[model samples]
Target: MKSLFVTIVSLFSLSAAYAQTWSVDKAHSRAGFTVTHNLLAEVDGNFKTFDAKITAAKPDLSDAVFEFTADVNSISTDNERRDNHLKSPDFFDAAKFPTLTFKSTSFKKVEGKKYKITGDLTMHGVTKPITLDATMTGPVMMKGMGGKEQEKAGFKINSTLKRSDFSVGTIPVVVVSDEVEIKVNGEFAKQDGAVAEKK
Candidate 1:
């Protein structure tokens, strides 16, 4: 009985040692998308307001948990009219559904520094499964502005989703391509505590 108790305690301690919570540095992160417009050129857009975090229980990120959200109203395309239209009922309808979110279900290491992340993406009041090819770099410790040691990590992820799958717009595919390519570039800092630090 004593031996069993010791083994259990040791396992618990090991688990705790491997767990880390990372807070997204929004200032250094971006979530963007691209789609073909009129079959002539690609239109690029980005969400200005967003948040994301990661809870990694393993060093290789095989058991990492990811959560992300972006404000639909913050979408920008560098064109005022197009941006406004995106906020209208013809597209995202920001007034009704103001946020798009993603929650990761699985993060599996596929190769060195590469992972397959599967998650549910919710947008325009619709939820669909999406998979991203992710490359993670560095949980390396470095000195911060004040010379305090900090741990940081970054990820570059790409995924393709059908706009119609989420019912994003009523426009025809010829005008705005049905397929959208998403890119997420994120930099995260280790949380000082269990909760993320507010900027």
Candidate 2:
């Protein structure tokens, strides 16, 4: 019994030691979306400010937790008028809900470098469960300033959600499609002192 208890404690410690936290390199990351406009053209926009983090124990990130948040007021589509409207009550009501966020509940590997992530998304004072398709690349080592070697990874995530489900927009479907497509591309850097074994 004593040996078994010691072995279990050791295993737990090893697993905790292997977990790493990777932070988004915002200068190289983007959170963007597209929605059909007038049943003809598509309007694209992106948030100017957003942050994300990933915590995982495995190099492949088979068991990962993801958290992301974006400032709703930083939304831009190039046209100031439309952007303001989006921030107003007709859409996001940015004053009431200044930020949109997502926290993952599950991260399942689908194939090589591909994963299905399910999470709770909160926006415009509402929360809903959503899933995204994700692809990951590289824990490539790169030399940063001062010639320090750092680990970097890239991710591409995509999802589609109904705007109405989050009470984001009340515009008729004919004017703006109910479906919104989200695309996020991010580069993450492993924080110092949370290093995992190289795959």
**Candidate 2 residue lDDT tens string, 18-93:** 7899999999999999999999999999999999999887776677789999999999999999999999999999
Question: What is the C-alpha lDDT profile of model 1 across 163-197, one tens digit per residue?
Answer: 89998898998999999999999999887754322
Q: List the residue pairs that clash in candidate 1.
A: none
Top candidate by TM-score: 2
List CA RMSD, all candidates: 3.9, 3.8
Number of clashes in model 1?
A: 0
Q: Where is model 2 poorest over a 10-residue stretch in terms of lDDT?
A: 190-199
At residue 118, what lDDT does model 2 achieve? 99
- Highest-scoring model, lDDT: 2
Model 2 CA lDDT for position 78: 98
